[model samples]
Target: MRAEPESAPYARLGGEDAVRKLVNRFYDLMESEAQWQTPLRAIHPQDLSESKEKLFLFLSGWLGGPDLYVQRFGHPRLRARHGAFPVDDRARDQWMACMLQAMREVEMAPELYVHLRDAFQRTADFMRNR
Candidate 1:
């Protein structure tokens, strides 16, 4: 018997809603965690509500769902937008730590969790400008 083709984990994880939860938890950690509180506090806006929504919408399209971000905000030159900040290894690691904690809080399949974590790590690394 042939094996099934691997579907994109994002789709299997329920797409937009799952992605939204992940983003929400990530920001929650940034808001609460001491290690991240300082750096992220300076970088992020006083209110993260809109930022969280934007991330959720952006990830919805980025994970191969509806292109909501582009439809609303045009191109997502992520690096360009984030370039204004000093994102070094410490910042990247802090972001990943928050994301990982968020992933754990969400009830995703283990395989999907690992897949998403790895993907986020790579993306976070790429986002580092300093």
Candidate 2:
């Protein structure tokens, strides 16, 4: 038996298209859900179309794909960019909820789904400023 070389889960999960789908689902949840509507609605732009695209591109590079975000938006100082918003625990949790819902919508392998969800949860927690 041979051990398979470790692969980036992002690659195994289907790259850019999959990432875009996930972001789209996330935005959909934010747009529709009342729990997330207050804080998210205030912080997020009136139009989330660009937000979805930016998040997709940002995730593409963050997940080890081509550096499209940098090419277009320069450095992604995530914390800095988000600093302007009041991201308390509630806000972070709502963000995670949206992301988790989005992950569920994607047809990823179980292990891949767990890994991605955990990673997103941790990152969302880290982004909490309050």
Candidate 3:
């Protein structure tokens, strides 16, 4: 039997395509939005292609779909991987702002939005190294 939508965020999110759209929108906003440019975008490399792909893979598994990131890149080690960057409250907030905007722009369900907003906040907070 198929997993219930409530039990599977990936399905609730419309699967891989929706996830990719959210990731792409997040990165696009980070790249284009003035508010995120310094705190969030500056920390990323000039090209966002790989960053976009990695986030997509990571979120795919994180949302209870295929574990593509682990399959391709092993454990996420999110904090450690992000340790090299100068992430702080500002960066975290800015990142969350961009993601929240993307989620809203994509019209995610209210319940899922609340769930993901809280979860993303915690993860973004955990990524802070400075």
Per lDDT, the best of the predicted structures is: 3
lDDT of 2 by residue, 24-128 (tens): 888989989988987877799898888888898888777777677888999999999999999988888888888888888888889988888788888888899
Backbone clash tally (model 3): 0
Relative to the unseen true structure, what is the C-alpha lDDT of residue 121 in candidate 1, on a scale of 0 to 100? 90
As for TM-score, the candidate ahead, 1 or 3, is 3
The clash tally of candidate 1 reads: 0
- Residues 27-49, candidate 1: write the lDDT tens digits: 98898878897566568889998
Candidate 1 lDDT at 97 equals 87
Comparison by lDDT, 2 against 3, better one: 3
Clashing pairs in 1: none
Clashing pairs in 2: none
Worst 10 residues of 1 by lDDT: 1-10
Minimal lDDT window, size 10, model 3: 1-10
Best-to-worst order by lDDT is 3, 2, 1
Whole-model Cα lDDT per candidate? 0.82, 0.82, 0.90
User: Which is better, 1 or 2, measured by lDDT?
Assistant: 2
Each prediction's total of clashing residue pairs, residues at least 3 apart in sequence or on different chains, is 0, 0, 0
Show model 2 residue runs off by greater than 4 Å. 1-6
